[model samples]
Target: MPRRLVKVFARLNPRRSPEDSLALRASVLASILTAELTILAMGYYGLITTVAVPLLTAAGFYISWRRRRERNLLIKLILAVMVVAAAVIFLRELAGSLYDTRLPLIRLFLWLQVMHSFDLPARRDLKFSLVSGLILITAGAVLSISMTYIAGLALFSAAAVAALIQFQLSEDSQRVDRVVAADPWRLAAGSFLVWLMLVSVAVPVMLVMPQSTQARLTSLPVSELTKIFSDFPSEVVNPYYREGGDPFDRPPQFSADSYYGFNPYMDLRSRGRLSDDIVLKVRSDRYDFYRGIVFDVYNGKGWEMSDEEGEDIVSSSPPFELPVDTSMPRGGTSIQSFYIQADLPNIIFSGWRPVSLFFPADRIKIDKYGSLRSPYQLTDDTVYSVVTEQPLTAGSYLRRFPRAGDPAAGPEYTALPDAYGADILEIEKLTRGLTGSYDNTYDKVLAVERYLKETYPYDLEIGPQRSERDAVAYFLFEEQAGYCEHFASAMAVMLRSVGIPARVVTGYTGGSLNPFTGLWEVRQSDAHAWVEVYFGSAGWVGFDPTPGFDMPGDASRDRDNFMLSGIIDYLGGIDFGPAGRAVSAAGAWLGRGAAWLTSVPLAQLSAVATGAAALAASAGLALRRLMLRRRQSRLATAGLSRELLRDPSLKGYLRLLKRLAGIGLARRPEETLRRFARRVSLSTGSADFEELNAIIEELRYSGRPRSDGDQRRVAALSLEIDERLREGRAATGRA
Candidate 1:
């Protein structure tokens, strides 16, 4: 090793002494704990052996540390056992059928840390253990994509900083007269500040840095970790298997209930609370139902799709056009961009009639029903743009002019199962008057939609129940109060009964608009079912039968009351007693600022902001440097010792006392330090102040020159007092 490298290593590790070994061991253990948690977050569930081996090694090390008489023998035995176990595990992994090599390698590194832990009698071994722990954490980072990993990384960063600080303090104890330990609160605060700074710097650098255009290199075939688990048996080592084997050899069965809105087969009778979690964010000129799937075949039980294959469109390149009926007249086009925030199916959601798609994929498939699907599963990272036509506008020429029939739609749209026989007749009875009341198919469809919406009340508390008859029939005649599914089903069946080709379409209702991002936030609870009648020349026209649920295009009509626009209006109209004038003035100021911002080019504004941030950072750095220099000069003039200047023991204790006084626990003039400490400890249920009092007493009475150890003890006690004070303040705030 280079001399400089050796010096750096020696500085970090130091020579192991009895007094410092305990602190080193504690630091190493903390690092190990952090590494373990990070690995767990990375989805490594086979940590039984990984955890057990380290714990056992720690126990043995503890025993060796306490009993020096048999230390050498114990060390020898531990090493021998560790070597044999490691060899066995290595050979086992080599012979195993596991496809992913990363997991086994991580396991091996974890075991190596365990072995090193037992040999941490020396400072070098402890340093090695810390490095190994860091490596394990980095490995976990490579494998994880969960948001929880951010939390894990934060925790690991704090722990690592603490460990390194403790290690350096242990090293300094050997060279300095007294090494005062830092306050835990101050240390924690400092660590947090450093973490924040790192994040701030990293974010901009990441944005500006040149990103690799090359595809990611992987040891194994690309696959989702979740899919791998779902594909293979728990006991089986190999995940890939031959398709269409024996029923017993197939992958484990997943409950149909798990995929409620996304699945082809939807059982309306099955009732459960739908999650309110945001699934997608959509930016568009107008609000529209983000259509996902289309089920053409509705049996008596539920809805499903036909087995007919979709035509695959090459979408790997940009601006992939979807197959559309050129004969159908096109209306005004709407461009929409979607950002998925949850795990959905391969289906791509868009408005009623999507014309083209822009996505990063090799191929996408489109069915006759105009449902777009990707070749791969859609994840949170998936982003796509869609351009769609406003097919059925209220004042469209196509709506006024109707064509004969669509042979292209075939008999599938009008086909009804034998199970729907009685329900079809029941629907005919309900919509029988529609034929006489309306001339056009559009008016007849609207009549059925209006009838269902007016008759049935919207309710989501419908419990799960099995019906002897068709679900739609049960909803129409029996359960009059149900959600959108029931209303849409009834309308579709009723329209079809009157010879109008209609199908129940499943997607999300128009979502709540977020004015801040100018995006519509579609949640899982927004999953809806609606009716779509084939208007020969006008194309598929969406007709929502659910009461109070308007189509996305119509959603703009109520936008002022539905979103931030409503909030602004309400704020403007409200009388706030004495604050009304102030509120109005503030609102006016904000409005002016928004107008100014809108007038300026965004790129120019971004450049100005960037320049301002850079200038501020530079100014801050210069100011900090000047302050540090002034402080050094002042210390020099006072002729204060470096040890005393660096130590915060007295200042920290005074701050703690001041904090206590603020909390109505002022120290008496006559009360001794120990007595006051004991009183405070008893009252707060904390003994932290007692240690600080002990250090103060030692510093006051002892005649001997202060040692590095004494300084460290004092610093540590000060930190403890500060931490306790912080806790008390936090608790008071919460109360």
Candidate 2:
């Protein structure tokens, strides 16, 4: 048999290896493609950056294949220099990412991966490329909050399994100068089966792991302030929605692309189903509202900010103090940074009582209401930071003050249009009814907020409010069910009529915190409005009357399955009509169940136990089959020593070696018997394996057949090694 195998090997010379198989090359490309795709999903790439990266990667692979005829040191040196330059650029850009530096580092490696693609001349280099795909995918998984990552991960895993399988075959084929026992389709099916098994194990394991509720964040950021262009009248420009006439007009209104409340004059009629597209990502020290455009004037129809002469804040740079109210008491300091993910209004959003700015624009217009507006409209990738001294807003502090009969918030806030008519009286009567029992302004605000939340359910499906009636009146008396806009508008107008200085504030409610990124993902659906009531010396305090919504200051402990919700949103957005909605609804149910399973300790523990047992059983069956096949092959074949497979001592030693390999002590093809014995000795923490190797070596070299006593001695050593190996593996927690 040995002579026949030698003759076969001689027919195909191992010295001059053949070109890489198409399967091997394609597998390598698939792995590279996965890494590139992961980098693109991170949302930082520009149009050119997005298009150029994958093109460069594909081009690099093509170059490597064509240039495989010869190796070039110069080419490698140049690519190395390019990678180094990319790293230098990344480091410079990293100045802005210090608050969360993981992403920029990952992005740097992505660029390195692209540059290194041109030099995968050897199988080892291709394998390295395959492994780097894992690194990139893992990094993307860590930073990405979207459920779309799950799909990308699936793609990478399948490709990686196939790549590893092809690599194994290629390595073996290279050793013999020809493919051995090759069945491409069978191997392909095996890879798929392996992937399926892996996915099955991973899903249950993940389902069993407890989810963390760590949304509250305190982080920092990147950017330098640019000199302002002479404080341009920062107009509200909704890039996706502004395909029309004045936002303030009646005829051309209600855009699905934009939140109506973001305009100069919010028309309550324009409230529709806002898209679930993520708009902003915020990293802040504490949970708080991203306060934006504040409106004091209620025109019966909607609300608008008063045309007070605003001050243009022209500064050389950022971190400058804002003109804040000296009368308002300062509490804990909170720092926040914003990453604009979508084109938005020119308003600068910050936590309550913004003390300083890190805005990029040279100048910002500060309205009397303390809201800041930038000269430039915010576009995607716009970055800024803010330092805020949160108002002494604890309930205990606010409860100490009484409701001022005449608030010091000035007449603009309390001024209601006479056009509101008797409808205004009805609002006053309702507000007084809700807050009549409360002695202090804080309690009064809470009472009105609670009443609205309980009585008027927040429903986004409601149509535009009637143009004939006051928006607030219609919301309170007729519909009694509306979203944040109607609730906020009603609350603001109601408070004003009842002699409390209140204004409607619009911006995004800080969305769910991404546990991985530590950033609040603010979606378009998260766009919200709430009322801020004045309490003489207490300053402006925020209140939300929308159902299922709380004040911005409150930290959210109940983090829903946001990842699953993202999946639902993604599915819902696909233009599949009613079927898409059904899919979305199904996803919602799954998300809820997942959230429950993760939250409940008993459920998680049970799942872990079940999954672990199933995996263990499967592994045991596979290992048993593998060992049985190897044992049968060895028994049938003549090999190893002078006595061949018939010799008892040699057979015993071979069996012992196979046992060691079964428990993950497999010897490499290049390892000598003595070297392999040494490694097994370390792995199993037993010298018995070495003793068995020595006996077999001595007997084989001495040209003598093994005696019965020698066979018994070998068996004894094997038993001792098995016992010790188990002890060693268990000690290391790998058993």
Candidate 3:
């Protein structure tokens, strides 16, 4: 009854369906399967689609094969219904944000591909399936943010190529009204080999290569707000850090996934290393520090935000206009979208001097230190966008803004909190000695920054500071080696002692720029701290006092070594070991060679290349022609090599064709044997080979077994054709 209803809804629209092609169906099926796996790899579903997709596609394939010969009006009608349903689902899913439509659109297309699989009776429908699979791969690439998607892309590409080759063979067979000799295995191998050759040619052309991957996404705008329940509107929340736990005692350090500096208070007394697990992915216009939280009140041990009661602002729409600090000199705007890959603090980490936000949360808080905060902890996959005013960060440009002590920056920024000993006095004396030569605040800040970096070696293996001894004092005077926090603390302390308004700021470094994905991959190990020294109208300019770290700035072109980025980092860490320096030296030499090549004019190189290619092509053509002529001459004179025939039945036929070719009467690729024989008879003024052609035709199509009489007739006919060809050749020569 259901089938009758469906049939009644649709007509028997039998649209030139081809004979059941098992090979073509299998290739298309493989391609569709590859695409499905790719979408799964791209994190399309949690459990529902993951389990349902495979079962549904498999069932569809089985059902399609079972009813391959049927002109099922019911199935077509159902598919039409599915198409409409999918369209409706997509339309319903459409939202204000572009990113919001991605998953729904993918789901729609993917399900449609699955549904279309069940009714693929025609070669055209199978081709449609193949093209649909290609689209799925493209969709996967669009969604992919890692180089791992290459595996799926490669698999789908091979399957699609095989399907195309099969499609071509099917078309050929249909045109000739017979099954082609090309089998599935041979088709796949030949097509893949051709595909590889095309890829090889294309790779160099692309080079003349551009990650071969770039930012497939224009924006990552999202809106999924989480309500804040804490006393402070936007309090720092680190899952790894124990909030009410004993301050003196260190928290459990098993995974070390979160950075301690991300908390409200950065306890220098706590010593451990952060994991390299990716915490964030940022797509930005340029590279800059993703500053999270800043601390003004600093004790001898650690740093903290004194003003916990921050001002909160609410906005229903995007983008939330952040209050700009009038004192901070702003320049061009930068748009950055942060994609949280791991649990992080509530801090709205943006480029320096943020003026606007696109965070999901309506209510956001801004503290005295100019750090914007979200309502809830940024869990995994949480995304937000921010637009910041990137200053003209040239040291000379900043130095132009002359200023004494910063009036805008309050006294809390410059004060050294009380400690046990006369450590403050000793630190003040030490800082004054280093900066006495420089008059301006910027120059003094530079001097302090330079001094700290030169004296201290950045090390992460150092033990926690003693309870009594100050962290920065010990780092500067005693230990002489510490990581980012140590360097930042020492610099900030020195700046404050020299009557400069400075504070320690913590967040992630401008992360590893994945050339493949074209996104900044910020990891837990990227958690960093640096000193922000206030320069009146120039504002709080960041300075990296760590030995190997550079202060994040708006670089015109920030380059990362892509070869050493994703894979090596994903594994524990990279270690070239003993010969690391030698490898580095070799890489340097290669870089120099590349640099030299870049200096040469492209047009001159192209001209020389074009000339060489033309010359090579001429030589190749000549060589191939010479080889072919020699082979043909040898074959024509070989006198009865019929024993070399794989099928003895076709030996006489082949012989006839070869002899006819010697007399300038070669059989065309598209010509039938009967038509060629008729033309041959006319040319020779004889009808001798007609009988042999008939025997072969019967054997080729009707599968008629050859008898002794047939074999004798074939031999006599071949000899007669050869004689006729010789006579024809002689007559032509005489003429």
Candidate 4:
């Protein structure tokens, strides 16, 4: 009779039947649960969904794609398109933000997984999904330092376990599947063991891997030309001065008897100063300072060309020729070396004077005013080496003013501005104050230098100045403190007044060397200026009077604080101090405290203890099975079990009623006993829906969740829904 009722019910309803296979059931559960868990985990960590969702989706796609050959061609095509679209989006995003532009690639992985969910025709599809899960977890790790990666990994592990379970059961359905379900304790124990093994092995590999291993690392913007000057430019500043005066040489270039002396120029850049932190390393044993530009004269408002200027500097493609006037002494000196790493522009800095320089494959050109330059900017690190000539000191040439026809006078110095006469007198007073006795020009110059160094302090800040203040006079007498320009300019003006020619010079001072690469890391802040007093034979003598400051090659370089910065960054990794530490400790202590509290029977730990609780649960399930078997077994002996099992209608209705209760509106002891019957009798739905109501009333009101009569009703509903809803939707949509 129950079997007859089941057949009637099955005819009326469908989809009440169990899943076609164990793998399909497990896959559905794993995918849905993993998706939900990953979403929650990423959300809790405060990660943007663009990163999290795409990662999860990619995992799904990987699982789907792994079954390539067996998957339907149409489904594969759809998934492929999704993957490509995701990649495009990811690359486009990279152009916007420097952060997490890699997410779109993972998005493709997700769309493929969704497509894979449709047919799932073979075991390979299940395997593919598992692989995708693993890939997704890996992608998540790259995007953050958050613990959400750990959670995704855990979900992946769980899915793997479920996949394994399904695989094992599917092969021997009658044996393994039923046998495993036969004892819930054994199945749960097996799952625990598997989880433990997977996590233990995975931890070591994760920890030992190199963190910076990225597949595509070489993406830099193309090199572009960076111009230093766009006007009628000279490499060196202040290039013109009067005859009989050489500012680069120390001491007086002329005597009072001659009336010829250094003509002082008002430094134009004196106010617009340049600063930099550019670094260069000299790897050669013989120290050769890099030479840049040389200013040969001084003009009142800074120097410029007195006559025809030279050609524009050009960057060449390959071979280069030196532009030095060879008829003059071959002052060239060879220094060989290489650039370890440098990222400054092509403008290389060197020592005081140079005759020739070897250029790397790129063409290097010298402008009319003697500045060597290149067209391209160095965005990435570049390296090169060269040779240069060193200037001799003052112990050689006798003190004497230049003749009227001499070439060093460069015709530009014949005229002095009429307005400078008053300023020159003020300088004479300051220089006279520094000296009481007259000797050779060098000694007299040294006396003035000694006085200035001892009397004035150095400062870089520019504060309010008096309106009529002369820069040189104010610094030497009133302010007594200023940056490099002030000290250099003051000395130049004082020397010029006393008939001892001098000029101010500017360039970069050598920088601190990086020990790791032994390369000098020069920065913009090293810009410096000093007075180059004419010393006749020794060319120009470089001496600094910036109180307590030492020149390069004169002092020990101080080391940087890289180690401290590294330690600070490392300490920031996991929460440790005050608020973060307190939060962590409180969370940890809460777990222990809760565990301790729960040890008293009802809060956390099982009331009966692990062993006792397991036994109790086992007994409950066993008692239920026993009661079920006893009631059904007796009826089976009467030939009812086999007959009812074959009755699809009864089985369908019973399954429908059970599934309905799960959705909500579960049967309760307080529910009226006749309520279910009324629902079935007056049901306006299909016959199978009505039949399920009556059967549920019989079994559930009778205090059983299922029965032979109910089973038939469940079978009918299963057939009905399968045909009407599931199949119908697809057919109409496709049509």
| Residue 579 alpha-carbon offset, candidate 4, angstroms | 19
* Model 3, position 268: C-alpha lDDT score: 78
The lDDT of each candidate is 0.63, 0.72, 0.72, 0.45
Candidate 2 lDDT, tens digit per residue, 570-679? 34444677766666667778777756654667656666668787878788699869876674444323236445456654555566555554554555545676876776
Off by over 4 Å in 1: 1-259, 395-401, 405-408, 555-735
**RMSD of each candidate relative to the true structure:** 17.0, 10.8, 7.5, 21.1
- For lDDT, candidate 1 versus 3, the one ahead is 3
Better of 1 and 2 by lDDT: 2
Query: Judged by TM-score relative to the true structure, which candidate is superior, 1 or 4?
Result: 1
Error of 3 at 667 (Å): 11
TM-scores for all candidates: the values are 0.45, 0.70, 0.77, 0.36
Clashes of 2: 4
Steric clash pairs (candidate 2): 96-222, 218-285, 227-362, 228-362
